[model samples]
Target chain A: MKAKKQAASIAANAGAWLITAISLVPFLLILLNSFKDSLGASEMNLKLPGLPLQLTNFLVVVEKGKLLTSFFNSCIYSVASVFLCTVFASMASYVFSRNRSKINRILYLYMVLGITMPVNYVALTKVMMLFHLNNSRLGIVLLYTAMQLPFSIFLIHGFVAKLPVELDEAAVIDGCSPMRLFVSVILPLLKPAIATVVVLTFLNTWNEFVSPLYFLSSSTKWPMTLSVYNFFGMYFKDWNLVCADIFLTSLPVILVYLLGQKYIVSGMTAGAVKG
Target chain B: MNKNKIYPMWFAVLALLIYSVLFVLPGLIGIGYSFTDWSSYSNQLHFVGLENFKTVFSADENYLKIIKNTLVFTLGTTIIKNILGLALAVLLTKSIRLLNFHRGVMFLPSVLSTLILGMIFTSILNPSSGLLNTFLREIGLGGLAKPWLTSPHYAFKSVMAVDIWRGTGYIMTILIAGILSISQDYYEACSIDGASSWQKFRFITLPLLLPTLATTTVLNVIYGLKVFDMIYALTNGGPGKATTEVLYTAVFKKFGTGQYAIGTALSSVMFVFMVVIGFFMIRMMTKDEVQE
Candidate 1:
């Protein structure tokens, strides 16, 4: 029995190590090859980058990929979308959770459908055209915010439903206006849920590809994902710069994930576990 | 009390305005457009009634292939990701050293854009000078290193492998959370009964993990059904349309060619698929939870 257990432990360790290696190798390849010349990166061996390490790949990627503009576009879209989604979602969640009206319940059910449904891109563009918002940053931001509202409302509703009603009673008893009550009392308590919303919305908007691709026709308005994609298309032969572009495109989200991994895991799992 | 009711209603207004305008309205218009001849060339819209649907179903039989590809992609990635994720979760939960590090490494790719992943793998899968081919040839398996992205037979599988590689970590993390929530006492009890590892896992772990598994499966299926960027980046539905031309890509192509009505029809079909699957998944999982 002891020998059997020992062997099982060894096997498990080996499997874990193997999985880790599989996961790490791609990132390692990207990192190592991003510094090498095109020939070295194409060789794609797992060796340390050679002497006279070329950092020009980053410069080349920025210049050729228009990475700075793409990065700026990503920031604007993600930040504005996150802000809009969080505020609107929080407000909606507060109402949905706090109210018991039949209308609210039905409306809540209706909004939750967005969680599963893919956006209707063709029709959406038409609506954008009607509003004269097509091919604009605001158009994309509003769409992202709308698309994300369902999930954010679902999550924040769960969070809000768990908050004690006695606090609302106390605030009301103190002659607090409903707006002030939410602002001064409820919003402060919703920090954790809001953090989750911000992280998730940020991640989604930052890494979004399909919407940006379809909605925006102008090259200057393209986000990092689209820019990297187009850049990769244009510069497929110069793989070192391609690697650099890829890394730069992924860097912000990767950093965000590494920094707020706990929030991300908890937020994602919170929604899953509840559902 | 009336004031309170009115205030909450006020809070809901902005969300409803945006949601109704951008999401619900577009969906309804999309369904409406499917029944009409809406295209780039035509100035006026004409009610076409089942024409686009007919094209999707019978006229263009290739659409059926795209639908099949979509189903295959969804089921293939969902099943593989769930199994691999569950296994990884079970393996990593065993007090493994550097478990967090391993978990983080596994999950790192999921955070990156799927487009970027596609680009990375595109180079890695290149026939002449790719890493995968180089490694395979070095190990005396040159025959296996075929044109992954270019060949019709291999393209779907290659794309699927990339999807699974990028996705497994995410589902693994979710399952890890689920597995951690299962109390150790059950395992202790099983051990006291002299239950083998397989027996304990079969009886305790699998049954309890079903709810989480259901959630992950639904999420994966939804994502798989909506997959566009990865495929677009990898092959653009390509090598003679060999790989999966999922509905979204089809819609994209249709729209590109100014086939607005057909694109809207495809979008409507996708929406229905999502609704039906999403509803059924939740219902099935709810039943599981109740039985438990």
Candidate 2:
């Protein structure tokens, strides 16, 4: 019986390592190929890159693939939209929690309902045109804000409800205006939820591809994901360049993931548990 | 103390206005336009009265097949990801070496852009000289290296597999959290009764983890129905007619070709369908939020 159990334990270890390999191999391929010359990367194999690694691949991709423009575009979209979502969601959800009027309840539900409602990108074109938001950086930012607000509001609304009503009572008694109370008293306490919101929203907006694909038509306005795909199409044969471009595109995300894994996991599993 | 005076309602105005105008209004207008012949092909709007819906529901059109593919992909990926995620969750929760590293590595794909992952998979699954096929040949399993994205019979499955790969870790992460939250008292009690390891899992773990599994399923279904980026990046709904096309990609095509009426109609189908789920989803998500 002990031998049988040991065999099972060994099998479990084997299974875990195998699955880890599946996850790590693709990334390793990208990293290895990014340093290879074009001929070296052509096979897309796991072999080590040649001596004097072609670090120039990143330079070529940055120039030819227009990586700098898209990287700037992604940064703008992520930062601008994350700021919009965090501030707006905090303010809105705070009101929804404290007010709880009939209209507010309905509005809160309406906003959260967007968590599952699929955006009609087709008709959205008409709205964007109506507002002159089509094909611009601001349009992408606004679209991402609209896309991310529901869940952000949901996350922060729950948190705001937990902040004691006495705090609000004290702030008001001290002649704190609503804006002052929120800024001085509540926003500091909401730092944790706001952090989660910022990180998650930034990641989502940074990784956004569809909105730019639909709305931002100018090549100059493309985000990293779009531009990387474009580069892949044009340089499909030069896997080295493509690897360098994707690796660079993914660098910000990898950094954020490592730094904010806690917030990311919490945000991801936020509504998952009934407990 | 007036609640209204302290917690003013106007604070919500910016978010509501943006959401209403940009997000909610488009869905409402799209549903409305489904009745009318609205298209870039013409400047005039004429009430068409369910003609678009008829086309969507018609037996002859590939729209029905596309709908089926979407459902199949959702159900297939959700179930497989949950099962595999559950297994991995249990394994990683064991007293394993580098436990955090394993879990983090597994969850990496979930954090990356799905479109980017699709591009990487496209390269790996290329017909010749791709890493996957090359590895298979090196291991003497070359016959199994099929044209992953270039064949009709396998295209849908291939897309589904890549999605499963991208998504399983997320489900696993949630499941691991759920498993960790399970109390140790039950295991102690079962072990005292001489329960086997499988028995402990079957009786204690599965039942307790059902809620998390359900949550993961909900997330997966919502993601699957609206899936576009991965499909767009990998196959663009190709390798044959309607083989891998879901509603979103098909709607994009309609929108691209100036067929606005059909596109809006297709979107309205998904809109109405998901709105029903959204009601339940919000309730599940906020079950403990209000605490009123």
Candidate 3:
């Protein structure tokens, strides 16, 4: 019986190793080929060091793709949208929590619909055109913020409800105005919910595809994802440079995940549990 | 008290306006337009009841194939994600020293953009010099190597495989959270009864993990239905449309050709389908929750 259990354990370990290998192999391929010349990398040989590794492919991709500008655009979209989502969600959540009115309840339910329904991009494109917000970065940011608000509100609402009402009462009795109370007392205490919102929104916005695809017409204004798409189309033959570009585009998010895996993992699990 | 009532309204005003105008309004308008003849060439709006739907269903047999593909893609990915996710969750929760590291590595791909992953894999799966074929040849399985992205037979499965690969870790993490939440007392009780490993898993873990598994399955299904970016970036419904062509892709193509009304109709179909699926899933999950 003991031997049988040991064999089963060994099988499990082997299975785990196989999964890890499969998961890592693509990334490994990209990393190794990114250093080789275009032909050498495309040859798909894994054994030898494609020796004398240099930064040529990376440099070319950066220069040609204007990686810095697209990176900045991604950062702008993510940061601005996350800020919008958090501020609006926090305020709305605070209100929803504080008020038990029929209107608030109905609005909360209305907001929850966004979680299940796919965004109507056809009409969205038309509306953006009507408002001259189409084909612009700000338009995408606004839309991203709007798209994310429902889930953010849902998350922050639950968190806000748990804060004791006594805190609000105390602040009010201490002569704090409603706005000032929310600003000074409530916002600071919403740190955990805010972290979740930030991580969730940032990742969503950073990796957003459809919004930018429809909204941003100009190549210069493209986020890294869109730029990468266009880059793939333009340089489909140059596997080495393409690998370099892929690595460049993916590196920042990977770095962020490595740095704050806890926040991301917690936020995601929190979302799943609530969802 | 009056201030409390009014302030809440004030705080909600901005979010409501933006959401209503940008999200809800557009959705409603899209649904409305789905029944009208609102193509780019048409100057006047005409009510074309059921015409778009008919065309979607019968005009070319391609639509049927698309529907089939979408269902296959959805059901395929959903099942694979939940199964693999549960397996990983069960295995990784063991007393492995590098458990956290493995979990992190598994999840790393989930964080990357599907578009980027698609583009990366496009080259990696190329027929002639792709790493996959190269590896297959090296391992004496050259017979299995084929044009992964471009082949009609392999493209859909390839796309689904990539989707499952990227998504399983996410489901695993969620399941891990669920499994971790299961009290040790239950396992201890089972062990004291001399329950075999298979018996313990089947009787204890499976029952407790049902709700989480349900959650993952529903999430996967919903995501699968809305799949666009990865397919767009990878195959783009190519190799002569052999890969899975979902509703969103159909709608996208309709709009590309200035078929606004038809595109809107396709989207409406997608929306209704999703809502129905979501309703049933919620009902099923809630019932399971109540039973638990």
Top TM-score hit: 2
Cα lDDT of candidate 1 equals: 0.86
**CA-only RMSD, every prediction:** 2.3, 1.3, 2.7
Clash pairs for candidate 1: none
Best by lDDT: 2
Top-scoring candidate (DockQ)? 2
Off by over 4 Å in 2: A1-5, B290-292
* DockQ of all models, two decimals each: 0.59, 0.79, 0.53
Error of 3 at A179 (Å): 1.7
lDDT of 1 by residue, B1-292 (tens): 5645435688988899999999989888899999999999979999989988998888347888898899999999999999999999989889778889989999988888888888888878888778889889999999998998888889999999999999999999999999888889999999999998899889998999888898898889889999988998888888895356888888899889998999999999888778777667545433322210
Candidate 3 chain A, poorest ten consecutive residues by summed lDDT: A266-275
Taking the tens digit of each residue's C-alpha lDDT, what string does model 1 give over A139-176? 99998999999889877887787788788888888888
Q: Candidate 2 lDDT, tens digit per residue, B56-166?
A: 999999999999999999999989999999999999999777889999999999999998899889889888988888888889999999998999989999999999999
Write down the lDDT that model 2 would get. Answer: 0.92
Compute the DockQ of candidate 1. 0.59
Residue B127 shift from truth in candidate 2, angstroms:
2.0
Backbone clashes in model 2, listed as residue pairs? none
lDDT of 3 by residue, A1-275 (tens): 89987888888778888898888878887788788887787664564545788579999999988898999999999899999989988998788767757787678767766766787788778799998889887888889999999878877877777787788888888888888988999999999889888887888888899888877888888999988778878987887888888899888788878777887887776545533
Q: List runs of model 1 lying over 4 Å from the truth.
A: B1-3, B281-292
